[model samples]
Target: MRIRKVIPGDARPARSAPGGEEAARDPQFVEAIARGFTILEAFTTRDSMLGNQEIAERSGLPRPTISRLTHTLTRLGYLEYLPRFAKYQLGIAAVALGQLALANMAVRGVARPLMEALSQRLGASVSLGRRDRLSMLYVEHAQPASAVALQLGLGSRLPLAVTAMGRAYYAVAQAEERAAIDQQIEERFPERWARVRDALHEAVDMHAALGFTISIGDWNREVHAAGAAIILPDGGIAAFNCGAPAFMLDRDRVLREAGPGVSEMARRVLSIASGKG
Candidate 1:
């Protein structure tokens, strides 16, 4: 897995940076670092282990370049090379960094206790998360002791296009960011987007009207959830989601109880984060 050290002033054979034309004009944009992240992102929950060739195909980078980057990442503990399968998975260092990032989020500390009380009172699961690409990555959650259907816990990613949490984030995102997100999602899911596009907009409009959104059996056929977004101290959007099994919470409860509950939770989170509470 180890490779020779990258020499000083090494020449880049293919400087294929992403972000299309915008990234091309940026003088300060570093391709080497960006390429490493692209490789890291090539592995998903379903494809947790990937060989160099698979990494290249997913990242749209050259195979040789993928090998070099994977070797470097393996050495740096950002990727773990599994000789048994001739593939690689994210390593402990990457996990540590993700955990550290979540730990440093002051809002998690402020939100989790409130989320716990809400979960208990509502008899559902409450989560706090932020957008990670086209997904919502849960940083913290509280589940009621009576048992829940969803197995999602910390670090679980919920798709942005379908889930309540994702809709809340999209609802709160600026216009430019929303357009970019829409383009990426459409590119990745062209066939599905044709069917989902109108509904997604409807949800966004609902959020605008009510300050929260609902997703009933969208992400999972048996789950019902609602999400509300709040602006964080860093000007980023994080959402609070409350949900239970579809049988436990019908459409009415999701709109009446879950939706407003998440909205209130978001306001409380914003108040504490902004030092107004």
Candidate 2:
């Protein structure tokens, strides 16, 4: 689904995405290139290294195909192969591309200082991210010097079905966009969505009323966060969240402190991005 704009109480109406040839529907779609990218993406935060068999299982491609793709990706500098472990992880080329993309994001430059200030004040980590197909990919972040702080940062992916950031983005998504995401959720994570459906709906409504949403022990049982979203000048929603481990922040403190902190930072970001600040 195309991105949509959402703001508290005053967002402009969303427009439908212009018609374009989608991958599944396009005759000119390159399956081999897509498969290669899929192989690279199979490496997640949990599994930084994976052999051909592991990549095949995660990517749903044949072992021979994975071997070919891995070899090509490694040769092209997108994946680094470890000889002793006989495994592959993302390589410098991939890191270069990701850094290039993040470096060019104007909003991130405007958000980082705000995030750092908030993180310092709350002793929590503040992150700015946008939706990356079925996950929220942190593009920038700030963390306090707390021992209990989550170590996730740039390139880290959070589950889109249950995390506070994902919920806030879903809360702000235009109706048609939300419907598209709901369909994807059912298709990609049916049982997980079923379990969180009611709570998600409630959180969306709370975002409507309070300009923030909470996720206490939903994504990570030890992590607690409050989330809010901002509509960029290009009409895309960027999700930002603040939180720490359960030992550092209880539910009541998250509601009273982190909720408002994240919401205020989101507003500040929107203001700057819109040239109003």
Candidate 3:
């Protein structure tokens, strides 16, 4: 099977203006820590075991820097080195940290039941996601009871430039943030940017007009999806999408039926999260 490629967006942490000014004045900011974390982040679910050169390519760090960071990370128990493959993978500490983060997120509990119900009703897969840097990170997923359903699961990350959930997120994002992300998309995906640009804008407009966004064979040629977003009481934005094979879920049906259902489900989830329902 040919695996689909998900182009990752720029995930470098933005420097805080105040902190940057302070660091410039104080000269105590540990740049090494940030670089080390960047090296660690280069390993993803798709690119789990990476050698120094691959790590350098993915993280945009120099080869020498990556070597040192990997060594340090391996020694610190944040990464494990595989001698046979000459690669490194995230260690137990990273798994523990991920588990801690997931345990603290209350939204999963609030949304899972509703997502399962919606998945069953529509015979599609329902997923809840949040913005993770420049990607939509799947936080929860529910699939229909049917034997055949999309297999996207929690921890799957999709590009912010093409996916329905990503477009819904862009629709709700602040204007300045959206502009920054758009510029990055244009720079990173110049070849495909022209094609995706129009579709992305259309999805945003559709979201504004219909309270949901639809994409048919845009992200993945075999899949069709619709998404809706809601702002939680804690001020974080979350999006839910329903997706299935394009042959099974036609565009018209998605726009007319699944779209509205997904949008209403998102609203109800938001209401419950905000203590209003």
Which one is best on TM-score?
A: 2
Full-model lDDT for every candidate: 0.81, 0.81, 0.80
Taking all chains together, the TM-score of candidate 2 against the true structure is: 0.86
| Residue 156 lDDT in candidate 3 | 79
What does the lDDT read for residue 201 in candidate 2?
A: 84
* Candidate 3 similarity to native, TM-score: 0.83
Tell me how far the alpha carbon of residue 196 in candidate 2 is from the true structure, in angstroms, after superposition: 2.6
List CA RMSD, all candidates: 9.1, 8.9, 5.2
lDDT of 2 by residue, 98-143 (tens): 8889887899999989999999999898998899766788888897
Q: What would the per-residue lDDT of candidate 3 be over residues 1-277, giving only the tens digit for each residue?
A: 3333233322333222222433665688776776787777676666678899877777677788778889888888899999999999999988898889888889899999999999999888899988876688888999777666665677877777678889998888788878877776786669887887788788779899999998787777878889998877887788889988887789998988789989999999988988889
Residue 118, candidate 2: Cα error in Å is 0.8
Candidate 1 residue-wise lDDT, 103-164, digit = tens:
78989999988999889888888998888777788889887776444556776677787888
